[model samples]
Target chain A: MSKDKLTIGTLLFPDYDLLDVNGTLRMLGALENVNILMISQSGDKIKSNCQVGNYIDYNFDNCPELDVLFVPGGIGTRKEVNNPILLEFIKSQIPKVKYVLVVCTGGGLVAKTGLLDGKRATSNKIAWEWVTSQGSNVCWIKKARWVVDGKFYTSAGVSAGMDMALGFISDVYGREVADNIALRTEYDWHDNPDWDPFSDKILEKK
Target chain B: MSKDKLTIGTLLFPDYDLLDVNGTLRMLGALENVNILMISQSGDKIKSNCQVGNYIDYNFDNCPELDVLFVPGGIGTRKEVNNPILLEFIKSQIPKVKYVLVVCTGGGLVAKTGLLDGKRATSNKIAWEWVTSQGSNVCWIKKARWVVDGKFYTSAGVSAGMDMALGFISDVYGREVADNIALRTEYDWHDNPDWDPFSDKILEKK
Candidate 1:
């Protein structure tokens, strides 16, 4: 076990995707010395897009400096992209965190942070047009399950967050650690970074 | 919107797998006229196997008869299979619900109800030996992502529950409804029922 602990904060807003935050939590929170903290703007219980309320561990103002900031996206991300408080908070944390992970339209929220400028990233394919429309400087990949641009990690959509988290575990913790977690979950992970079939599925609908 | 609302009850014990319940919720709860209710022995919030507390919507004593019963397996399942109170509760509901879904080691938990006798089922591959040991009369399949034996659906492991839920939605709802949900999440769902590769992975490890 690593004696050194890494405080991993997941920023939650009202109507956040339940699977988006919870799936990543499975891999990231399971690791030893990785403290998982659910954070929200006011420390109030955040309702899921599914309407279930999730308890928060900390309010934005009181949260400690994070080693990893995990951001998940949902219907709420559309409104929060324009929230100055959230944008400023994300901006302030970018320089402090060791890594920044954005899932689904979470990339949209992070893109609003002015952090994805000149970085390769991705977001929910179904909402691709709307999500990428917010980030002018971002070099968005159209077909990727996930993208790793230096310390920033962005995934395609809801379930793809799990794939990115495992990939992240492989990058930071070791492949063996992630493989064991995958085995434990029995998740046949789409290990190939470009194995994004949903991109075409979403596009084909048009 | 379907005016016929179905109360989907997820059976919660201490240390339940969060992904098993939440992942399926992302699919089933997203459907029209589906009510997601988390039920436990007590209405008090149940702690996930990962230690995060999930608020329960109802207690066993007052819960309305469910349209569907969702059972998820985890580390705590090892102790729950022997609980007479839980087995009796599961038995009582088996004859009332329209569908019974069990995920991962949840197969072990449900098998104790004696409801799975002679029914085709599957469970978490890693815990295959111990889980199968619990339900000798159940016809356990080794190479299946999910087994839909009439109204009962049992799946391989944690993540497999989501795939099973999508399939369940396709069966009860329509393909378009399930496809729309899959598209909204940008999920490349493993549509093939027999696409379980983890069966070999676990066996090879032995």
Candidate 2:
């Protein structure tokens, strides 16, 4: 890859969890040849529920071709799932991107767009049912750090987005690169040997 | 406390974790009457690692008359600690604000301002030593959700800022109001009886 040349697109919508979007962006920015694009439903600044900062860059309609498309989840996904324009855009872009990454409730959006049907997927624990309800073809994985079924990758809850992004980096580059990225971000990234999404271990009493 | 009259200010700096700042802003936006302000050392569009968005307001040279001041932390704190201009501004405004809330590494900035001297404080676990080293007069509470020593309220890590803000609402208003706010925001505001700042159990172990 050329220096910071990987085109990474982050989806933005009203009421989306800014942390998930920003956290992933922070990690990706550390890469030498990464070009991060903030693509929103509209070509305008996206006002987050956090109201801290408004995203601006490319609109879904005007975004340049992307290498990776990352969809972040939040309460915003509840409405974005049904947005015809947004769904069409996502559906059209899936085939062109190298990787499709979804975080938390964002997995539901991917599932809703019919991209994750029959593919393994995961989302925020509270919204796993909603993700499943969107489509039965998706093999929903519960409490997974992140699930990779084919080229579609999904994660659980807010912070999990960072881990999933690192995982994607590992897949594209190498584990060493991902670990160095994690260290630079001050995140402790580990592969859980005992963790099982299908097992009752996560369900065991804390 | 009047409707649409609350002016909330958040300090932004280089390398600041956008999540900590945005998360707190999202919670505050859930309230009916609050105007958010993004203050930076420089009155320019502050770029973060996430590339999610740009700050709208700037309070670099002239501090806005604010109802509350929020400071978020990240690797940026290391640089902010030695910034004479920023430290002077924080010191000048410590006594004027209704509340001074410091999140994550931001607590270190507050500690450097000498406002937390002789008061209880907490910060990101990794930077606890740096915070302590900055000033020995402060009681660095190792295991606490947030240290509410007088008007200075400090929380641990990035996400803990949300809990600390909710607690601030509870203290300023009441538990019932805070609970209502939590319900509206869809956040499960649990009183973590075991919330120990120094305890390794605070975060999910890798």
DockQ of each: 0.66, 0.30
lDDT of 2 by residue, B1-206 (tens): 33436788888887777667765665666676777888887777666645544555776677578888888887788888999998887888788888888887888788887778889887766566776787788888777667787888888776567677788777766677777655443344544523753346433342
Query: Each model's RMSD to truth, in Å?
Result: 1.9, 5.3
Instruction: Give me candidate 2's TM-score against the actual structure.
Output: 0.76
lDDT tens readout by residue for model 1, B1-206: 33578888989898888788788888887886888888888788667866565667888899997989999998889988988888888999999998999999999988988899999999999999989999899999999999999889999899999999998888878788888888788777887879888998786678
Return the clash pairs for model 1, or none: none
DockQ of 1: 0.66
Mark the regions of model 1 whose C-alpha exceeds 4 Å error after superposition: A1-3, A204-206, B1-3
Candidate 2's C-alpha runs over 4 A off are A1-5, A26-33, A125-130, A142-145, A166-206, B1-6, B26-35, B60-64, B82-84, B128-130, B142-145, B159-206
Write down the worst ten-residue block by lDDT for model 2 chain B: B197-206
TM-score of chain A of 1: 0.96
